[model samples]
Target: MSGCHDCADCPAAKFPPPPAKAAHVIAIVGPPNSGKSTLFNRLTGLHQKVANFPGVTVEHHVGRLRADTDREVLLVDLPGVYSLLPHSEDERVTHDVLTGLRPGMEPEAVLLILDCTNLGRHLLLAAPILNLKLPTLVILNMADDLRNRGGQVDVAKLSAELGAPVALISASSGEGVDKVYQFIQGTAAGRAKVKAPLIQLPVLQDIPKCRRWASEVGAGAAYRAPEPPRWTRRLDAVFLHPWAGPLIFLAVVILVFQSIFAWATPVMDGMKTLVEASGAWVAPHIPTPLLRSLVVDGVWSGVGSVLVFLPQILLLFFFIGILEDSGYLARAALIADRTMRKFGLQGKSFIPLLSAYACAVPAVMSARTIENKRDRIATIMIAPLMTCSARLPVYTLIIAAFLPNRPLLGPILGTQAAALLGLYVLGFLAAVLTARLLKSSILKSGGTPFVLEMPPYRWPTLRSISLRLVDRARVFLRKAGTVILVVALLLWVAAHLPLQNGKPPEIGQSFAGQIGHAMEPVIKPLGFDWKIGIGLLTSLAARETIVATLGTIYGMEGEAASHGLQQALHADLTPGGALALLIFFAFAMQCMSTLAIVRRETGGWRWPAAQFAYMGLLAYAGAFLANQLAGGAVTRLIAFLQ
Candidate 1:
């Protein structure tokens, strides 16, 4: 500054000083499964913006809340970290933001959330954060659980001992959250303050010293850790059993698979009917043939194909939420750890992979929590292989067209549901094989022991589950309205170009058809025709886009009917071809967003390029083999039966 001031006559003097940050940023930090996200959702409600932090792959969420005076305050929900030490990318980003090392994201205050039931242990994290001398509110979450388990802590004493205010709140239930808001309001008004500790804190760099100091502080406050919940222990005994656990998990998977097919069919049929009706009603009103085709065949048919899967997607996420809220997913992770290690992956990889079933983008981002570099890369590489919700539309369309919905095993399972479950297992097996190969080769690294905190099981609240579904629905509809809509419109335009006698030409004679024809020979071995080739090209934008592409193509070709996309596909595909298509999608890296995320997470195109190429080859080979073998088998079965 002195040098710059002295050079006032220089061009540098014309530059203005950097604008001082004015927003009061309050950071919410806690260890994993401590209900931090629940609290964030509670405080922010629907007013939040999500983006990546500068120069990092980590996601950032900033939400606005109104203070007592009606002034706005910004809350930054940081990644959950056990410590301020930079062990993983998540921890590093949190550490940077808290320490002001991350430009423009420094927090004015901290909401240090701790699991109240395990306060003594969670207190260890408070030392380094308190030393930062930020106006901090040490929030002991899960107050209801703590009291129910017969634990107690003198909040005033704890506040005095730690030299910061403490608030006992159940973030999930919203009890005592008002105090958190008050602390936020006070901090925003510059009224919040922290006193000198009653006992001197150890240096931030000294782990053992800090641990001892934290324990002493807790004792001074008369903190008592809660006894483990009885049902939790009992359930753990069964759910964590080596053999029974896997069996139980298998049963749960089967139930979910059955429910997806059994329960969602009615809703899907209703939605399909509604979409068709809308397209029919709108078509006549449009008057112009070209405009009518664009509106009905392009927009309506395209988006509608993907929209029909909304019920199934929501159903999948519903089970995931219940399992997670019930605290069973943590147990599932522990059970999967034994098998994961054999494939050169740790238990942490399983979480991202499990989440990959919902979507791979967030799952890849979730791998940031894994401390090991090689493990994180391996998780990201194989994440796309999992059968995500996007594949549901295509899978269902193909299955309904070819596979009969007859009972298997006395109606506990059905042919359609079994086929769906088989596809899921197929994806998981492919992921494991790929992970093993990666770990054996370039990404080879020694294993890191898995450690996880098991949260106490609780009944999932209706509010939380509904909020999750609503959020998912929002994302789904937004994609349909934007990306899918645009693709559908483009496809329609391409199909109508080079008009004959000022009317649209046959789809096979249009520009889109030419591209599909050119690619047909390349995919012919896999039993895909030019129409499927066109769908495949569009699907690169997203795994679900193929449904929209096919919907538009078939609608324009006058093949779609009252039965919709499934009926249209039945005429175009053989049983072997449909099975091959499912296999191809199960293995392929069909999502561009996933590739972009991989590139960002890996910090280069080299990894994503290699990933795309490897998966592409595997998908091709798998589909080709399935088409050849299954084709002959199916043909022979028909002849033999005759």
Candidate 2:
């Protein structure tokens, strides 16, 4: 009989035949800044999920790996730990998972990833992990850096000394990654044997025997120091300076924002033309008025509204990847910490806040890294106020139509750019105030001490950055696409219902119109017509839906202009009305998806409901104040000129 068939005759096989395939659970562990996350991303590609552990705010990232023809491996990325003996909440998570003591899971094997250049220090944690008696593999990542520093490693000798499979890998370049996969496959097939490495820890006087063992095992595997990169040191000089660093960071941010509009203008204009042409094409062929309205007003308007901002979104993510990959993001956080702290936030909060500029869902999810309950909650609460890219469509439409193009003082501050800057400032102010209010009231509690590891600056791989950008774009298209589509259909149905006298009722007399008219008594004081009121209501599903809702309300012919929605609004709306609309969008909590994510993250409806309530009231108050002040000021200016 074949060796694989032996189990068929055994008593254990009475119920059913056991499959020959073996499943291995591999946990990847490393110290902070050791490229553990980069390795995880490389191995998993896009197949991963982030879940919360029971009763804790920590995130658990799990991905599946098919390492061989017969075996499937489950890869778990544990939080980075400084030592096996935990000192913080996140570190405890790592400790528990490694020891198979974590609440709901146990790993069958462990992959210990270490930075090659810092092997001596990394071995401190490796010693304790080895004592668990689990099958283990050691990966010396960043081998490229080691080789570039004129340092070399003898892999065969190192493996023999360490008593574990050892592989030298450059995670970013995918070098030596295949060897890791091969080793895992062999181990899962029961064809590979690894003895527990003897670890000698001279520094740990409390465990002399363990120390001696680690020393003997690590001797040949370790290498002498290599020269540090001169460019890293030179860049650090300017990037880490207390006074000059923040200024440089602000300048970079300004340039990135400016480039978003400047670089994406051509693509955006082309998309606008294409959308208008498509609308014109559909209008003539469709005979039924209702069907025609749905196609032109609902699908065309809504999808077109969101797609027009694709260029801006892509450009924003492109720069975000560059900053994150180049390691400037951490330095920016360090420099902004003092200012952020004054508002009851830590330096690490900058990551989530900055992420919110792309979208708030990921920003809230990223807040799990904040250990303190109070800080995490406060960060989640304020993240949505950070002017996400979705707001750009509304802002672009308003500013282009209403804001003058004249230069102020110099070319540096054109009136158009200045108005955009003012909106961002308002968003920042809103986030700061919201954070402060939450800290003192509902979320009043002390936060854990912030201790972040700053990684050395390195050149980000172009391939990796491009891949990440594409991944983010896909995610946006998937999640936001569905929500926008449904909301658009609903808006179309609402605005087109209750046909009167065999002709489709105008928007002012339809179902959405009646609702808006009923609410007009309240919103009219803010200078909003019923049409604008309807736009605000639909926008609650997603902020960008306002543009689509407006396009639909104005009818098909109006939406087909070269200037598109902006020109339509300029011809249709008075300056005071435009100002009121901008203010409304600026402060509104206009995304239900963000609310649902908050509920999931916070584990209750209380926080999300409260967030919606407060933001809605704030939006109304801000819009009312702006309309009154702006309208009165314009009237007085006109009288003065006359």
Candidate 3:
């Protein structure tokens, strides 16, 4: 349990409230895709923090709502589920909390968010929850969608059918949602009633009785249904077409990648210019040489190199937001479902896998949504291979270095966009293929069918998109501001140390260079030298640190440091080295944070250790192959052009 700190004489502690003054708990439970998350966000807004349920890795969102007169409502949004009879880990978690079976969890009331258009079916879930006798309110989201389709749920009759107040609302549009919140605040203390199941339990087939009773209740409530699923059928035809759907999904992904490079170029350039100007202005004013160097080259330059990529990161999130909020991502999942089944995964795994492109840690966390154990573990295992945004910096740099930007497939698509698209495709292929291997060999699990509702397309609100954008920017900057900052300072010291005999320290003789040199022999096979070795070593903390590490290393050099990193690489690295490094990063397990999260999720070092070993081998092999193959192709192409 969580409580508000600002409230005067708040009766509860932050968590695990004393039994005598047990904190009021309200559970927001619903079936999957029933607008559970949307309602939670609307109720709590950005004032929410997620923490795991007592002992489980499954996290619940806790938020506060203003209640009647100088108090706040503590809201716990539970995992989405079909019924209290749990089949999945998440469903089990919800059931335990509601039943007081799980330790440290006791709910005082429940808010049931149901899909309005399918009230009869959604209420089948409500019957059991209602029997718990917790003060409950039924929020029928998608009421607007239902109404537009010439359907309506009779609220007055529904309030009578179930012994709970019913609110007709569209969580997306904020229609009647306030009433639901007010109901929670007003009734949590005394309204919830624990009682027997509403309909008599059937002797042998209780499930069918539940269904029949739900239909009967629908009739009693005068539940109105919309027009037949004609448009949905038609839309599914094109979007879920056996062959065309996948192609459309592919095109959408390609467009996103192209936009990342094409749309963000000007912004990226502007950021680069700003950093250079700041460096120029700030560097000469400092009095001491070492202090000035640390401020300019170590701090600003290292941080700036990574920060310039924020535009591309933001643009990527922007497009992803559109896809998700538009409901097309669900269709994309449906389209991928066919191939996913062949690999022993259902469509449920697709969301987490898709989310991996943003970052693997959260994607892995999102795997809790998947019901099956093996399926969840499998998703977590291959999630890191999804070509996350951290790879964007490395990819952009390498593509700029090795690949010429000639227009291909006419003037619209360039070699740069195509190459970038190709890398993402490679990552997808790698993830699917690796999952197949793991499913058949290590994990050895049977396939589970994917069950999901295609949420109606809602135009994403500016507020929603803006909130997400702010959250993403904060995460990116926090990583840059903290981890990269510390690493940059350390790398600066490493590159500037060991001055001896009154002569200036050389990078090759400094501690950092010596460390890089030690690993140089090992990495030389993959077309890397000591400087790249240093970047690779530093990147164990974070993938983005490679850029900062390289910036710090190069910034320390006398004349070479004056050149931009791209130019320095152009003069120093061969096309083969650039391609090989790109391939390595595309496949490598570079982020220690990802591995740590995996270990935590899997509950042991065994899985993360195996993940590290296999991913490392693959990265090394991939880099070596890229070096050889790309080197051969470049030589032959040059000969032909000559």
TM-score to true structure, per model: 0.78, 0.76, 0.75
Best-fitting candidate, scored by lDDT: 1
Cα-based lDDT at residue 325, candidate 1: 80
| TM-score for candidate 2 | 0.76
Give lDDT per model, in order: 0.78, 0.73, 0.74
* Least accurate 10 contiguous residues by lDDT in model 2: 8-17
Residue-by-residue lDDT tens digits, candidate 1, 1-642: 222221322212332323553567789998877788788888878666454554455655567764453345678889887788897778998999899886656788999999888876788789888888999999999999989888999999999998899999998888999999888878878898778778987887788888888789889989888787998888888987878988998787666656565686788779989999999988889988988988997889667856776776687678767877888877777777777899899876776776677667656755765656788899999999988877997898787777767777787997789889999999999998999999999898855445677877788877777776776566455533455567667767877877888799776778878889998999888889999997887777677667767876777333354268787787888777888999999999887656755765665578889999999999999999999888878546434533
Model 1 ranges with Cα > 4 A deviation: 1-22, 241-247, 346-429, 442-447, 479-481, 520-532, 538-586, 589-611, 621-642
Displacement of residue 623 (Cα, Å) in model 1 is 5.4
In candidate 3, clashing pairs total 4
Q: List the residue pairs that clash in candidate 3.
A: 133-193, 133-194, 134-192, 135-192
lDDT (Cα, tens digit) per residue for candidate 2, span 372-476: 667788999989888887799789878777665777759788767777888889988998999999888877764546666666788887776776666555545
